[model samples]
Target: MNEDQENDMIQRWVRDTPEEDLKPEDYQHIKTLGSACLTEGNSAQLLTFIQDEKNQGIVKSMGFVLIEPLVNEVVKKEKSLEHCQAAITHLTRVSKLFINHIMRHFFVSSLSSGMTFLLQLDDRKAACVGLVLSALQKQLTRLPVPYTKQLEEADEYGLCRCCTALADFTKSFVQEIKSKNGNYVGTTEDEELRTELLKFCMRSLRELLLDAELSRDRKSSLWLFATEIMVTLPAIQQSLSELLFFNSLKKSIQMDDCQSKESRACLAYLLFVQLITIESFPAVFSPVFVLQCNMEYINQLLSRYAESHLLKGLALYAKSLESVEDNSLPVSLLELQSFYNVPQNLRHILTDCPMQHLRASGLQVFQLFINKLDSEAKHKFFRCMLKTRNHAGVEGYIIKNIKNQVEFSMKPGNASKWFLGVEFLSLLGLVLHLSQGAETDLLNSMDRIMESLNLLRYLLIRDKELRSRTGVWEELCRIKDDYLKMLRVCISLSRAYYSAELKALKDNQKIKAKDQQTDCVLCRYVSQVLHSALVTFDLMESLIVRIEELTEEKLKIPN
Candidate 1:
């Protein structure tokens, strides 16, 4: 048969469900071998049959996706529900091939996404979703094992298609949960199914939290999956807390420090904070053994991945506020402090960390986290700033980047675009609030504002067309009042008996920025190190206001 004919057959196979009377066990027996076979590295047929379905096999493709995988791994002794329970654990344990096969099976390109199909199976429908989702999460976050079977994710178009499919699956799973909260004690079959599912969820997530020896490929993937699972755990609450101490102990062995340990740990902690679950915290953060982390490897990922990566991790840990259960997820702001900032090992990567693809990806991860936190959480985050006043792990960057914006006037060219964006929005917003004196930290410096002012002037000088753009002028003008408020802060802070702690940083000798001569010791000290654009504060603020006025109609720059 031609490729088209073969795809048609596979699609029909998926759409054609076996008789409804067939036991889930019988279904398992028939499909398990095919599933296992499909998982064995590259299956050109899996991709070909699924990808080229000529609008004919859409439903069949989904059916075949489930049956093919079940056929591969199901054993003769494994009964259906038991096999289903096994299915979850089996997929989690299988080599990455399983993940790839499952993912390709669910492949719905952006083009085909809006194309609807008759999806009628009840139990199997959810089972397929849970299985594939569980598998994909593992594959994406974890590093692929040595010589693991691989496929062409190299092509940009294919990656985009995969991303689209993944997004759809994630959305569907979320919607399924939102559909309703069915009664748990309603019936025997319902109870049995829930029990099996709970086990599956628990086992996979446990691996994520407590598994000590995750292969490098699985490590990162598991970290992300673990977080996504948190959103599902409220319903699976009992399973979440059910694991015995012994089981928890066994899993702890796998968490031994490899390179991404800190980031993994951070992800684990973030899940707890966001989900408010304490069920597995002790297991995941088991201080069971005193494993020393490889500080050098960590520093490298932090510096190279992003200053923001390090910052976000530290902030999430420090702001661990109260979880829903008593002391569930209990690493205090102080306990987790050691992981923040560039440790000696990672300093080399931080030296001019490029804001290229890698760092940008890290930023995306950072946003995924911060966006989940509500306003109260955000307020709590800042409150941690008070706790870390003396601790630089979290505050050093904020002080260096935002509060020290004036120093950036020197090389404004090298300043990070991310830093500049935050400088105008969050940090500066904080400064403006603090300057109001309605509730301000008098110790805050005004020199930061002056530096941003300088940076703005620099931008205006270089980009006349930008200056001419109403949006640019609007931004500068709007923030003009903010600058005045900051000026008040500088005066207030300088006038107050200084922190005395920062006196050294405030001294003239410490400054290295060339424009330092005319500025105050605080301004010079900060500007010396800052690489902000040398735009004037008022002009910078005005630029934004102009931007707002010109495009104030809320146009989306037609990207």
Candidate 2:
């Protein structure tokens, strides 16, 4: 048949073939004709026929039977690079025509099948892998935003499958490189092909790392992929390290100057930091550690950018040191400690940085160091912290910080303000707990109780104000109710204990042989505890009343 007649015949067959009734043999026949058209340099006719949008549902239903098996067939032939490349190119072109959930699955599966075959061909693996990856990258990039949004919002299982497939492809590609023993002694074309493949892998990783559409769980899979590559293939570690660090640094720099870019850059920085400090992986002496030895790198980061995310990244890097198993500190860590002066830096950050997040990071680093220390060291550290102005006054400082957060949240268009407020409240609770331990003398418990009541009162007022404006009373209600319940029980116990102590003091006063001064001190202590308990009861009662008013107002709102 002439080309025009053949084309007309295929078009008729495509139209006549009922999608529901089509069998494997029918798809095989179509694949055969498509392959012939591709070989005869009439790809335009073949593409136009197969890619007709009207037949998309039909084509999508036949995707696995039509495309995947053909890909497998081409892969199984152990063909020359040109043959394999042509097959992949044709498949890629056809895959682009139908971009949907079903097509993505079929396309990725086909590419994965091809990759399995290509990895076995020592001479052609580089070029073949590059082609397959390029195809996969194109398909992923072309994923419709609505589809991706669906994955992000509700289709966690589908999202996980997609992320796993991407990670598997990355793992396979890295395995191919590792199989070569980091030696690519091939022709210029082969070397260039390998370079392109590496770049493709890096780009895939970059996209995965920086993909804002992905949830943390999906992004974590990518981190696992990158860490596996870094652990198994030493050569790529340096390049991957440089890529992640530079990308994070770039984003951090942008974040410092642009408030609008903060969320994206901050997320990217956090993911990169996780990649940079793959402490969960078994320890290998990596050259990347050498970068840590230079205090100048950290100093430059601190001196150059005042962003909280950057500081948080640095804090995470420092925290990674605790993962080391040996008694002796890593030389890099020692250098970090000696030069960066982590405790001093944390003190400075806590005292100086106006941002709550930075202060939180500082606290995190301090806690990490404390946890790493021995009991004696921890004791000394706590003593030192108790004496430090910032540490001692952390409650007041954190309350002020929370007030600042509340003020910021009051601004219009702050969607995340409620979450930010919750975080600050949680932080306030933590500071209150820490302050309890800071009071070394039991005689000062009364003083600590009063301090806590004052903090709680301030928090209640602030919360009341916030609730009045935002109607965000659910969390505050829980906090207030829980505190009130606990305080009521404490007040009852204190009243009982005070009555018993008064009876004992009266008996001791009657017994002249007893130590009058000691009895007097005991009486005074009981009175103080009773006084603090009553004050706390009054404060909590006021808070409850305020909360009831807010609840009433909320209930009055029309549905």
Best by TM-score: 2
Where does model 1 exceed 4 Å of error? 1-106, 109-131, 134-167, 170-183, 186-559
Alpha-carbon deviation at 391 in model 1, angstroms? 19
User: Each candidate's TM vs. the true structure?
Assistant: 0.28, 0.40
- Report how far residue 525 has shifted in candidate 2, in Å: 42
For residue 482, model 2's alpha carbon misses the true position, in angstroms, by: 40
Q: For model 1, what is the C-alpha lDDT against the true structure?
A: 0.37
Query: For residues 193-301, could you state the per-residue lDDT of candidate 2 as single tens digits?
Result: 4465445544544344334333335544444544443443243333433433343323312224232133223332443344443443344534334334322333334
Q: How many Å off is the CA of 265 in candidate 1?
A: 5.2
What are the lDDT scores of the predictions, listed in order?
0.37, 0.47
Clashes of 2: 0
Best by lDDT: 2
